[model samples]
Target: MLVIFPACSVFRFQVSQGKIIDPPWRPSIAGMIRRTKATVVPVYFEGMNTLLFGILGILKPRLRMFLLPREIIHQTGKTFKLKIEQPISYENLFEQKLQSDVEIINYLRQRTYHLAHRI
Candidate 1:
């Protein structure tokens, strides 16, 4: 920030030191008409398309279904996987009793900490 501020100030002073902007070419009559046509045509088409589709999508069920994902499945089948297909988080153990190794490790940890603090 300290480095950028002084450079920005210097650039601002140079621009304020008298200079005038001149466009390199004056627009010809044909160029102006082409620019106007290019701007108007796409805007008119977009507005008309938006209004046409907006009404049709609301009035037509098939068109609306084509535009949106259908909630109902065309085919139904029961899942037959016997075990979890994805990796599981250890947090699921919170609802169950701690396994034997976990209890042993925790007991050792507390015993070591208590002995060290007592000494």
Candidate 2:
């Protein structure tokens, strides 16, 4: 099974001024990884937040919020970039000497953001 975890607990719209937020990632994902020995693939989407904000800008905020799902489904002619890094082996994760599950998750979170910056 594939499990997707966001680096932050909060949504992008919760922040003001379109600032990039780096709230602490939930550590439960790391625990799950350790228990299941799941290989992790760090993935980052660069333009998704911008697209959402741009849509909000064009339409009334409240109405847009309600229509966001439909807008995303029906809208066309927009491009976004995504980067999927090489998978991290379950053994490799322990070999890193991260000290704790939280640290392992933090390491993965850093790699994901690094991908975002590079893209």
Candidate 3:
């Protein structure tokens, strides 16, 4: 399935300011996973946000690519890294019903936060 960012979520950041903000994770995702019995794979990308290029992207709103200008995006003078955690089973998530959608979202956000902090 394609990854789509719902409104008021990650893409709304002003400047890739090296901060981790947890926007609401739509419950619909959980619902869909439950319906389809799919595993939720959390993939984290580090350094995907470069301040200047990220600001440009925020301003432009149309030129949407993981990286805007190849040069400036990496101009932060930092290298990038990617982390992929083990797929989270929907069955397991459903079994653990105590965690709400917001909690699940925050958990995922924390995963990303830890991943970002590496760099």
What lDDT does the true structure give each of the candidates? 0.27, 0.71, 0.58
lDDT digits (tens) for residues 6-119 of candidate 1: 111111111333432111222232233233322111000011113333345446634634532331232134232221122212333222354444452343233323432341
Candidate 1's displacement at residue 34, Å, is: 88
Winner by lDDT: 2
Candidate 3: tens digits of C-alpha lDDT, residues 1-119:
75644323344454566653445667666556556877777767555455655566667755535444564545565766677777778776667663666665556556555665563
Global Cα RMSD, each model: 33.7, 4.3, 5.3
Question: lDDT, candidate 1, residue 68?
Answer: 28
Model 2's alpha-carbon lDDT is 0.71
Q: How well is each residue in 1-119 modelled by candidate 2, as lDDT tens digits? A: 68575553323443455664545787888998999998999988655544655456445445545655665665377777779989999999889998787898889998887886673
Ranked candidates, highest TM-score first? 2, 3, 1
Best by TM-score: 2
TM-score of 2: 0.69
**Which residue runs of candidate 3 sit more than 4 Å off their true CA positions?**
1-23, 57-79, 117-119
- The C-alpha TM-scores of every prediction are 0.17, 0.69, 0.54
